[model samples]
Target: MRLRLLVALMGVGAALLCAMPAASYAQSCEMKLGAMGPMSGGAAQWGLAMKSAAELAAAEVNAQGGVKIDGKQCKVVVVPYDSKYTADGAAAGSNALAAEDIHLIIGPVGSPEATGIKPVAARNGQLAWNAAYAKNSLEPKFPLMFHIAPGPAVWADAVIKRAEKEFPMKSVALIAPNDQGGTDIVSVDAEAYKANGIKTSEEYYQRGTTDFAPIVTRILASNPDVVDTASSPPGDAGVIIKQLRLAGFKGPIGRLGGPGTAEILRVAGGLDVVKNFYWFETVPTEDPKVQEIDSLYKKLLGKDPVGGTAVWADLPAARMTLKAVSLAGTDNAKAVAAELRKMPVDDPNIGKGYWTGKKQFGIAQELSFPFGIGIIKDGKNLGVERQPARPD
Candidate 1:
C-alpha cells in the first residue's frame, strides 16, 4: 500500500508538470510593423526621416511598456525596407510584407511608390498607412489602404481659397509633372480657380525636363500672378524653381506636395526665392504638440526638420496607431483601424487649438491638422505668415 501511494504521488507530480505551460524561448516583444520607402536613392532624405519617426514612436511605446495585443504586452518594432523609389521594387516589398505576420504596415513615401503597393495591401488582409497625397481610385476600390496625407483636391481648394483672401491673384499658372499627383492638383485647381473667378494657365512637363527657360518664358507671357507647381519627386521641382528664378519670374509659387520648395530654397543660392514660395504640407515645428516631438527629434536626429514631406507626419501617425492598438487591447488590424477611424478632432497629440473632421477612408484625421505656408526668409526656413483666421 505504501509503494502504491508513492507511485500515485509520482503520477500526480507528472500530471502537474505536464499541465504547466512550457517556457517559451520566443521573444515577447511587440509584433513587428513594416515600413517601406526609398531609403537609398534620391528620396533617401524622406525615407530616413520616416525611419527615424517610426523608430521614435517605437522607442516611446517600448518605454511605456509597449502596446498590449491579445492580452500580451507586445513591443512595437519597425521593420523598414527601402524600395528604392521604384514601382516593381515597392510591389515586391509590399508583397513580402503581406506575407509577414505583422498586422500593420506604414509607408511607401512617394505617391507613385504608394500606388505600387496599394493592390497588394488591398488583397492581403494587411493594413497600410500610406504617406502620400490622396488619390481618388484608392477609396472605392482599395478600402484597406489608408493615406495619412490630405487629398490633393482638399489641399488645393484650401490654398486657392486662402490665396484669394491673402493675395490678390486672378491669373494663375500651374506647372506640374506628368504624374497622377500632379494631375490631381491641376484638376482641383481648375475647379477651385473657376469657382473663385481665377483663370488657370496650364503647363505640363515630364519628370526630368530640366530646361524650364522656354516654359518660364511662356508662363511669364501669360503674366500669372501666382504659379502652382504640383511637382514632387524633389529634383523636378528644384530644377523648375531654379529656371523660373533665372527667368526672373518672382510671383508667388505654390508647392502642392513633396520637398520641392524647400529643396529649391536650399539650391536657389538664397532665401530670396523661398519667401515667394508657399508649401501646403505639414511642417514639423508648426504645432505645439510637435514642439515636444521636435525636441525629441532634434535630440535624436541632431538637425532641424524639413517641410513638404510625410516624414513630418510619420512619428505622429505611428503614435496614433500604437495608442489606438493599446486601447483596443489587441494588434488585430481591423480593430486598430476601426479605432483610428474614430479618432477625436481635438486629439491632444495633434497640439493646442487644433481640430480635425470625420476620419475618411483614405487618410487619418491628423493629416487634416492645420498646414503652414512655410517660406525661406534670408536663407532661414521660416514658419507660416499671414496666418488664416482660425476656424472657431
Candidate 2:
C-alpha cells in the first residue's frame, strides 16, 4: 500500500515540474549581482537551479528598465560562479567576486562552503545572501552574513517533534553524510531526538555514496522504525532508498530537501520501492500572492516558476538589498547592509513581519523565510506528489 502511494506521488511531482514553460528572458541591464554556488560538483543541480532562477529574476527586473534606486534606473545583472562543493573553492570564488567591485552576493549553496566564504564576505564589506542551511553556522557572528532560512537545527527539531507525535516509534535511525553540513545537522537531530525521549541509532557515510547495502543492513539490524536522511538533491536519497528496499528493509525513511520526484523515480526505477521515503518540503501550494509572483516571473522569464525554498530567499533578498541600496542612496555594501536592517518584508513565505528585532551580525541582518515539512507519496519513475509534511 505504501509503495502504491509513492508511485502516485512521483507522477504528480514530475507533471507539475514539466508543466513549467521554458523561461523567457528579458532585456539586459547594468546593475550587476554576483551569484555563487556548487556549479561543477556532485551538487551542481542546486547551483544550476540557483543560477537559472537568479538570472531569470534579474532579467525580469532589468526588463522594467532596471530597479529604480534613488531615482536612477540601474539595470539588474547577475555574475555567477561554481564553487565545486568545496570550502576552498567557495572562498576563492567569493574573494574573486569581491575584487570585481560588485555589491551583493547570492550563494555558495552548501553549508560548509558558505562557512568557508563568509569571512571573505565580511572582510570585503559585502552582503552574502546565503542559500544554504548550516545549523549554528552563522553563530558567534560574522558581519555582513545574512541567513534567509532556518538552519538544520530547526529542521532536526521539527522532525523530532513531529516524529514523537506522528510515528510514535520507539527507536529511530539516522544516516547522513560525514561532511560538515551533514554532521552538524545530525548532531542537532541527535540532541533534539534524545531531548524528546526518542531512542536513536546513527551511521555516517561519505558523500557521493551510491551503494547502501551495508548501511541498510546495519540500519535494519538496529531495527529503527524511522530513518532520517539529511541528504539533498533527492538523487542520493533515491539511491539510499532503493538499496534499502533491495536489502528487504521495511521501515519509514525521511529525506531532507528532495522533492523532484523525477530524479528519485528515475534512479529507483519504481515508486513502490521508495514509497516509505519522505522529505522536508518547503514550497507552499498555490496561493494567490505566490500565483501573482509566479505570473510576474513567467512574464519576465518566459517560464513558470520552479518553486523551491530558495525562491523565497532569492526574491526577498533581492528586494531587501535593492530597497536598502535605494534608501541608503549609495552602492557601498556596508551602507546598504546597514539600511537593510531597517527594512521589513511581508512576503507570504517569510510570514508577515519586520526584521526590527535581533541582528544576525550585529545591529543588522535578521532571518527571513519560514520552514515547512513535506512528505513524498504516490510516486512513479518520473512523477511524484508531495503533501505537506505532518507529524510522524
RMSD of 2: 13.8
> Ten residues in a row with the worst lDDT in model 2?
383-392
lDDT of 2 by residue, 114-192 (tens): 8788887788777776656665345435667775544444455665555444346666787777777677666766777
Candidate 1, residues 1-392, lDDT tens digits: the string is: 99999999999998987765322211375478887777764356666666777776666666556777777777677888887665676788778876777667777766667777777766666667666664442454665566555555555566666555655787888887666646765766677777788888788876546677878889988889887776455655666777777788777776655544545655555476545665665543466664566566566446654433455556666777778787888777778878877765333444422322234343333344555555543345656533331321
Relative to the true structure, candidate 2 reaches a TM of 0.78
Error of 1 at 366 (Å): 7.6
- Whole-model lDDT values for every prediction: 0.64, 0.62
Which pairs clash in the backbone of model 1? 30-74, 30-75, 147-362
